[model samples]
Target: MATLQLSGVCKSFGTTPVLHDIDLDIGEGEFVVFVGPSGCGKSTLLRLICGLDTIDSGTLTIDGEIVNDVPPAKRGIAMVFQSYALYPHMSVASNMGYALRLAGTPKAEIERRVEAAANVLRLGPLLKRKPRQLSGGQRQRVAIGRAIVREPNVFLFDEPLSNLDAALRVDMRAEIAALKQRLGTTMIYVTHDQIEAMTLADRIVVMNAGRIEQVGSPLELYRRPANRVVARFIGSPRMNLLPGALVGDPAAAEIGVRPEHVRLAGVGHGLAGTVRMVEHLGSDLFAHVEIAGVEERVVARLDGGREVHVGEAVSISVDADTSHRFDAQGKRMAPAHNDRRTA
Candidate 1:
């Protein structure tokens, strides 16, 4: 295993800048995920680390060795791409051992490594099958097994589960998590899927427009986002942004509250609004409420069934301590007190 580090990394195509002063340190045996919308340069950063793309300006180190000019093969890293790039004619065993064979490893060693990878990935029964004969998930596993046989210091996965069906994606995710635990190898994954980042990463790097928005643990990003963009991006249904003048001292131009934090109140509640819509998600219900004076929509996540219905007048209340204040520029405002309540 190896620790990967990028310092002052910058990349551009022609005159168009894509990454700016990127700095990140990935610990040995840690799983770090890069997540962002398309065109955010998450994949570009990964390619740079894999040595597939040259860096414009920065230093990349792996296990204390500067490797900015190192070729992909010499970097001792393996990349599993979005597409399962398995040779159709080669059997699974041959496919997994092809790299070793090409490197002139002993035939016995190649066979042993191939068999071990097959057992680890549960591909023993399909060793003789070709890519055409395997399911999507199986083909992906073969691709991963091919990487494993190389015994790389670091593994890079670029949207490896994006091609699988929903059920297969979930199953493959669990399998990959278990595989990492068993192998204990450092891994860097790139994906736009927030759930994947939240569930699989030790720390997530949220990027936007070629720049990092925030870096934190899943729950940390969800609970205490550094900015408005991250606050909305990390949560399901997203957080509700309301336009309200500060009611007291240390007030900001706008306030942000999560759906779950907005509670239904009786007549004496803090904010009054008309329920616009309600979505029942089985375990929870989300309501879109329109505050009278504000044009922005406020959402509330209610536990169980709600007694309220659309078009009905409703009052919502938020614990003042839990609200996030934001300036006009969308930057976060620190809470006035440290004793803010949360549910």
Candidate 2:
């Protein structure tokens, strides 16, 4: 019952446009993550959905109602911000119950709801502790618990874990995932971290320059990116792009192969390159090489234990079946058609 739909959504900051012609549908009980580089308007889109910012033009609907003009507080959405935003002077229980109390809920009702949320968040033992006394993770839990007590139709998280350290971010990610399963409420989260998007989202909406580039399950986008920009964005080391001629394709403007897909082979059998640098991460090794005719360096991934020295001669194999072809306009080309031209 918490479905959200945005139709032709547009937003502007003064004269400059920030989001453009956005159209999306989020099903009830689905966890969707918005991911993009900073300044891409993902967080702005979240604000529009939460009613914190008004859209320049679009229809915003929740469930069956048009909520474009609804105030954030009345929109049946609760937002958890990047900052914990807990009141340092307030006890955890008080902070969680404050909203209900302000709404004139009976004291007993407030206590009941707060207790339920606290138990769900495992903050029962810390209910009497002030925010100042809590660790970063506990403060975040209190922030989430505050939203839980409101029982909104949708949960909107704007980089809620970005403030935490790496270890705490991983732990909180698991906690949030469990919360989603327990609540089964529609949740829209925004983050620039691809790992967070990949690990947590049921589906990820990849945005770029105020527009959505692609939307799909994590692996789908990772394996079959719609275009060049997406091909470069989703992966850690990113896909290695080379001129089509490097792969013996005359028609394709570019061909992309993931670092992991680039196999080190015997000399003269694959693309010739000299290793420029090697990054060893204990489990994996990434070798950066300068391939002939390739404008940018190509990176190849290997087992961590492999000893590859800088300036070593190496060749990388990229199979046709595994490579992605893009035309001059940066759009992905059909494999059959693309291969026919090469054949």
Which candidate leads in lDDT? 2
Q: Which lDDT value does model 2 have at 224?
A: 93
RMSD of 1: 2.4
User: What would the per-residue lDDT of candidate 1 be over residues 242-276, giving only the tens digit for each residue?
Assistant: 66363342366667888888887665456777889
Off by over 4 Å in 1: 244-250, 266-268, 293-296, 337-343
lDDT for each residue of candidate 2 in 259-297, tens digit (9 for 90 to 100)? 998888657767788999999999999999988788889
Off by over 4 Å in 2: 336-343
The TM-score, computed over Cα atoms with residue i paired to residue i, of candidate 2 is: 0.95
Alpha-carbon deviation at 327 in model 2, angstroms: 1.4
For TM-score, the strongest prediction is 2
What's the lDDT for residue 287 in model 1?
85
TM-score (C-alpha, index-matched) for candidate 1: 0.93
